[model samples]
Target: MVEQLSLLAGEREVDDTAADIADPCEESGTSVSPMLPPAPLNGLSPSLERKRLQAYLALLVGDVAILLAAFYTVSILYFGTLSNWAMLEGGMISAYVILPLYLTVALYNGTYSRRSLTEWQTSAFRAATALVIAAALVNLLAFFAKSNAEFSRMVFALGLASTAVLMTAMRIAVSRALIRKWGPTSLNKMVLLAGGPKLNLPHALHVNASEHGLEPALDDPRALDRLSKYLRNMDEVIVSCRSEDRAAWAQVLKGSGIHGEVTHQLPHEIGAIGVVHYDAAGVSALKVSSGQLGIRARVAKRLFDATVSGLVLLIAAPLMLAVALLIKLEDGGPVFFVQKRVGRGNRFFAILKFRSMRESDDNGAQSTSLEDDRVTRIGRFIRRTSIDELPQLINVLKGDMSLVGPRPHALGSKAGSKLFWEVDRNYWQRHGLRPGITGLAQVRGHRGATDTETQLSNRLLADLEYMQRWSLWQDIAILAATLRVITHERAF
Candidate 1:
């Protein structure tokens, strides 16, 4: 008989403690809290959350309604007059046959990840895939029931297209509003590691933390003997200086009995049960490879940014002009305010904004908050509505920004500054494409002051998601969602 014992790894405890000490007070001279309770998703802000729920409900109800409507329309065209009872009967049977298939495929591919819905092309492709799958299932059922001739293939096709369009648009609208309301923030799973300094472990870990949502706390090889107490908190462990510390590594793993998946930089090969070799930041190491976004995804993502930004700038020109004038009349200053922002590849570009602050309030490269004294009355209003960002349409047009990508940051942003990349190697991975005027993060309600590293990591994850699966229609859908977010004053 095997007895199950639960022990927290001591190595993880050291890592957590080190993370506390390693944090530098970057914003407002206060130490941001690292221990964040799980975010409350139950009563997420009612505006988008409620709307999203309603939209889902509406999809199911509207799906049934549309099926009925289509049947009636077809019945009238094919057989002249039809009774209400006949329409209801036809609609019920069709809906029962089709809706289950639709729901299964819709849920399977995550058609409902709010941020994913904003990319229209992606949504449409998903919609097409779901419909095709549903149709196949429906056809099989039709054959089994021997009622293949009862329903017209054309009606099914038309109904599927209409429902897909309706549901996609509804979801896109709801997701956009939610993101803007929430502002590109999420709670992420982070593992902190403690290892020796000889392997330059801290620097490599910091890089992974900034880009891949992995943060390293502190490294003390001596602490390994007490690993049993902290193993649960850690998803992966990195051992530093494989050459000199071979004995220490074995002692730590053996004493803890915490064997599953392990990673390390070893001087000699020990042939662990499940380990792979790779170079991290020019350092030789055996790291358990966790897949990151790929190169082809990066290229397709750039193409997505270019096309959507071009189309949106063209279509939204007149409204953008009105916003520009509104800013000028309120402040009597330059209509557009340009400032240096860090883009993909550590490149710098002037990000455009509608000048939401007073001209005299230039306080270096500081982020403005709701309580900032520098914001003019009009500035506050525009900022809240996110109209102040309208000038960025030009950035998109000029190829400095995308219609949908990660939101660009000032060169000195506190969350992940330009210096962050210099210190943390993986930070540059975010610059795989042009920045976006509105992105997966921005719509999810992450804006203004980001006082925590966890928040920054969350935003980075959303950006990477967009990169991994990008499309032009997705950009257009994001732009539309952006408009809704701005109008509703979700961001401040």
Candidate 2:
């Protein structure tokens, strides 16, 4: 009888495995029919390519308009009229010389042809740099032509400043509008994930994949055949397979006639490190190194943290005192709530905040809800405006935190009734740097109580991404983004 039961269980397992690889159209809701062969795999369709070309032309035209407008506006403001044909002629000559140079520098900086448009900070930097370089070139040209004395320095300066501001603003506005209109599909890439067991990707990655038009192709006998028909629609194919199955999958991808790059996924856990080098010997070997910042970088980051936090604390001292008084008068409890939070290297630090909750015996372990009864009227207002968090500037001054890093959580914080660390092994990895009063995750809309595993996972992924891509400029961007984030409905 036991043998018969085991055989039944084995059959069920086989059926389940078969079910996992059934035609993907049924699950994905795609319009492609399973019975018909996929369309021939080829390069992008002519219509699609034409659309991209048109978009590029439109961007170029817009930029030229901005350049001409800046030049004319600056000239009018400086010389009082277009009646100054000499100054106008010089401005025209400068524009003619600088336009091509600006475009060339922008191309070199990946300003016109990069996937970073969605990030306004990167786009703004590239635009401003390109304009500055073009302005410098214009100056050089004037010197070489012995016409430097013929042009007014004020006009040149005003033109350069106006052009930079206008161009940066235009790019940011256009990029944001495109993102809102098309979501991540504006990226213009159709990625296919093929082979292996499905990856349990972080929630943030899943959202990004959806935004970027990533789709999964079931690992079935017909997957390669189905892929060939849809090749024209796909920009890239990413194969995820076990090590033993990698060669077979590669061959399958190569035979699909996709006419584009085929990439394979590495083992996620083992490949999470930044730097890796291959040693070409009898057997292939990889050496991975920790990607920690150098001593100079650490010193610079520390200096920036100290300087910015100190200035902010000084400016905010009066307001903070007023909030402290308000909190004290509300319930006569302690004005500041100092709680032990996990900081860099897993050390504990007392993070300071204006007390926003009624004094209770709960130790602040439970996550606050949107309508929690424990919140005071003053607390609600302060929390919504993020005024309660101003006291954490003290933590920043004390070196317990940075102005921008992963936010620290209280020792007993929970996600869905389970400790956050228990929810994800990688939760503690965010401690690689000092905790922050405002972080990348917070600005990206992951602030407030992490009530579920998905919330915790998304926040953790954002933190990890920030750690991997840390830069001084990125910190400044996060700080700037915090202003917008504070006005979000979820900020409370």
Candidate 3:
């Protein structure tokens, strides 16, 4: 029956007219043999499976631990180097106690996931909330235990701030590094069985698989034979369309002994509506829930951004003005530097910021670095304090940006002239919404020079996470936490 179905369904586009294969037994004076090939899967081998999992876990744990450790070391050195609480406590208590606590918090927050714990703002909010709650709880416990006097709030705050900065940075770094090393999860294991305009190759495959949270292995139906082998080996296959020849495809898939499904039913049947799935090991892991940020959510997010950015601009305006005055005095150039930036959907818009360097297009579109000579003395201080970013409130006001979204990249920014998206093709996928002032990238220490592909990739992950799952409450919370980070220069 399966062979009969395959013969009937012979290799043809799903939407094309269905072909009829006469039954072999009914043929006159002739015997017909089924021409169907053996079903093949488009998946990794067992050895490859084990290796991939091992590699993923190694990257996850090794990088996470390294980042946490670096954060711990930096915090201890910065806070303990001065003759403050460390001298009084007689040990590196800030490093010991607070470091462990922050690590615990990060772990609980799932910072180690290939996908980030949450969107940048959401993660920042969660991390900040966790730190605050943890601090309060610990302090209360210390008070009850009569040990509050043993610890200094300054040192404790320092530890938390350091952890936030370093943890965020490392998360950014690791994500970027992994993305560069392993490529975006969006470009994996989906097979495109498309027909026409309603389902073109590149986009339809992108959308259908993206909708199912499944990355198509390859888009060409000509490679379907090879893909079948891969899927059979992987034990999972996604047909990705309901065609006139759906039954034929089903037979081949069934014969291949792989679990499979149509893409249209994915949203409801699999519950993985919009959440993107990458490098999944099994059909069970293909699970994803739609993460839609609708009108109500957008309205709420915008209101939250305006309120928070407005309040923050009000409070920080004096300092921002001071920095602007200093920039003018130092270089006698424009106080606010406006540049074209790529926002949601590759839209070009002006991003406003307190100029941190001498007004010159000297380096073309390169990112500024710590040692960049163009940075003025006052610019250095303001940049470190993140005060230079204050003028972006105007951007928030103009609705060109959010108080918290993925940081915008300069117009000519590129991964070798391809733009980050063109380099990975999945880069533009993150641009589904507005960019922000302090994003997952900034808060997590990806704020400085993006000299490498890994850094941009990590930043992209954070931005995508934010767009995929965002709320007004999350925005408000990010705003508050961002205040602490800016005040302490945790995010650089």
User: Per-residue lDDT for 215-308 in model 1, tens only?
Assistant: 2211311122112223322223344432444344433332221222233545335534334343343333444223222323334655665676
How well does candidate 2 match the true structure in TM-score terms?
Answer: 0.43
For each of the candidates, the C-alpha root-mean-square deviation to the true structure, in angstroms, is: 19.2, 21.4, 22.7
- Per residue, candidate 3 scores C-alpha lDDT tens digits across 87-144 of 6453345345544565576556644332442233444555555566666667777779
The 10 consecutive residues of candidate 3 with the worst lDDT sum are 1-10
TM-score of decoy 1: 0.39
Taken over the whole model, the C-alpha lDDT of each candidate is: 0.51, 0.61, 0.51
In model 1, which range of ten residues has the least summed lDDT? 36-45
Best by TM-score: 2
Which stretches in model 3 have alpha-carbon errors above 4 Å? Answer: 1-292, 362-364, 414-419, 487-492
Ordered list by TM-score, greatest first: 2, 3, 1
Q: Residues 178-262, candidate 2, lDDT per residue (tens digit)?
A: 5664454333333233333343211101112222122322222123333433333233334333456544444444333232222
